[model samples]
Target: MLKKLGVLAATGMIMTALTGCGSSNNDLTTNKDTAKPGSEKAASGDTGLLNGAGSTFVNPLFSKMFSEYSKEHADVKVNYQSIGSGGGIKQLTAKTVDFAASDAPMKDDELKAAGGNVLHIPVTLGGVAIAYNLEGVKNLKLTPENIADIYNGKIKKWNDPKIAADNKGVALPATDIFPVHRSDGSGTTHIVTTYLNAAVPAKWTKEQTGKSVKWANVGTGAKGNEGVAGQVQNTPGSIGYVELAYVIQNNMTAASIKNKDGQFVAPTLETVTSAAKGALTTIPEDLKVKLSNQPGKDSYPIVGTTWVLVPENLTLDKAKAEKMLTMLKWAVTDGQKYAGELNYAPMPKELQDKGVEALKKVKVNGEAVLK
Candidate 1:
């Protein structure tokens, strides 16, 4: 098997001939003259850089970065596929991609199958916001339990008292509650379900923990964050969960979620940062962490962190892999600069340091992948 499958080549990409995962690295370059319009060169390299696949949630961010990076580092070309996290994980396990972006980290059994050298790099931080289009009643708030009940079909109307309870005097319209979900494998769904599993354990079990869930009600499925955002915006009394950026970009109304301390926390860069600050520095090598009911009183209970997948250990293709790591490392460091601009929180200094250490574990050419 060719291994590097599902990677789509961009037309008129103008990027230098990218290397690795079927992209030719030998022709990599750092010249803008080589890449197509909209792509910028970032690093000085001989072979065009190659990276692709995973997480539509991070798609806009990385797409922007890759385009900007191509200006100075035009020699390296970055191509990514928004094929959803499930496909990204599949491509990664099959050694088909240079890197895989995922909102949900890989599990222990998955790590073992990866054979030792997977680098779990959290590039940027964003929150999944509950967006809705209601008539007249704009200020909407929901506890995790309330959200759970809505998704579980327990509460069928937007004016349910459970929802109104959180809003106090806010008048919610008496409308049919329409819940839109992702049709594709999604980390956004994972984050939502994970929170649901915590706030409503009986409803959100292990079976419902991943991307797609079996809901008691029939909800329409949208393809990705963009689709869901559009669907929710156009449909009155419809609600959906997507990265905060989507909500902001789409100009949709976001619900304030109940925090661990019982305060309604609006999904924001600051609140998500507050939540991630509650996470520990010492996560297992597998990068799996349960994010629900965290200790921080300010922490938004529904917050989540995304992970990028790489080879388990350094490999003969270390140089190419380093291109992936270096890009990711840059995404975490400098990437945070743009995060706040895009409504994403920067990783805390503590976690940032730990993440740098974790990057060291991303090896190249049978040697520890260089710093």
Candidate 2:
């Protein structure tokens, strides 16, 4: 049965340190403004404040990108809330934020509820690391079946036969396996569930894919990527799925998941980028696509793309709209250089071009802002 763990007292310290790395107040501007081709000039006396929420999956990159953008434009300030993707979409629909970010593209019904003018502009690519807390185990290998069963509560011990089969030589403990998941709505949840659903359909049904799912009565729930990372960090024999950056930042142990090509791939910039190759060619015109379980020898199995959601026809004042679009355009273009350092993959040139084109559709009061 599922058992909930209390939020650990040390979790706050871990999150504080993790988020501190990308604090907006820190001026570490090292890049030039190369967005001149479609840049917008901030009007005099404009507050130039742009507020956004969503996608803790993209938080590190967003923290750096927004900070750098503000450095280049003194008048423009960006405040992004690293809430889960679901909360961000809700804020966007409620008109409480200027933009929203999510790893999972909004569903058609969600799009329709927001006046049907929203555009999904992909900003970064990353892997959902299957992080675990097991002593004396440095390298762990997992298959889709092993994962499906673990979360399904069918595999209750760390040394379960299914898990042991993948790591033949490793001495796995017989400790009870604890699975941690997002307690709130999250796009990270979407990416992991989507991968599980596709990789092992019979075990992880389509009904389980989305921003949130009724996980089997096993494991506990944590609030954000940091929360999950912390849960895994503090609990021995626990396993959780989190964005790759958090795994890196926390120095947590991650598993090498076997891909469709039968190769065990670790999450890296190259592997995550490789995961997008198949999807890039078949991506929809809306730019809404999934990159999990792609057919490539080098592709990481749990990768996903994060997008910034902006209304095609903005309701903000002309100045605010112009500045907001300008910053966003920069994010998808010049801002990409900062992604790799934070454990995220820069968008491929093809996807970057499409993102720019989508941003061009944004208008303020029927007048195009990018032109």
Q: Cα RMSD (Å) between model 2 and the true structure?
A: 7.7
Question: How do the residues 1-371 of candidate 1 rate in per-residue lDDT, one tens digit apiece?
Answer: 01011121221222222111111111222211122312321233323557456786776566556766766565567766666676677666765556778888777776677675567777777788888878776667788777877777888987787777777788777889999888778888998898887777875677877876676665688766767777887787788887776666546688877777878777766777777766754565545545555756677677777777767574435566666667777777766666665666776666666667787776554566656
lDDT of 1: 0.67
**Poorly placed runs, candidate 1 (over 4 Å):** 1-46, 112-117, 280-291, 314-318
State the C-alpha lDDT per candidate: 0.67, 0.81
* TM-score on alpha carbons, each prediction: 0.81, 0.89
- The deviation in Å at residue 80 for candidate 1 is 1.3
lDDT of 1 at 140: 76
Error of 1 at 55 (Å): 1.1
The number of residue pairs in model 2 that clash at the backbone is 1
Best by lDDT: 2
Kindly list the per-residue Cα lDDT of model 2 for residues 247-282, writing each as its tens digit.
776677889999999999888778888988877887
Q: Show the colliding residue pairs in model 2.
A: 2-217
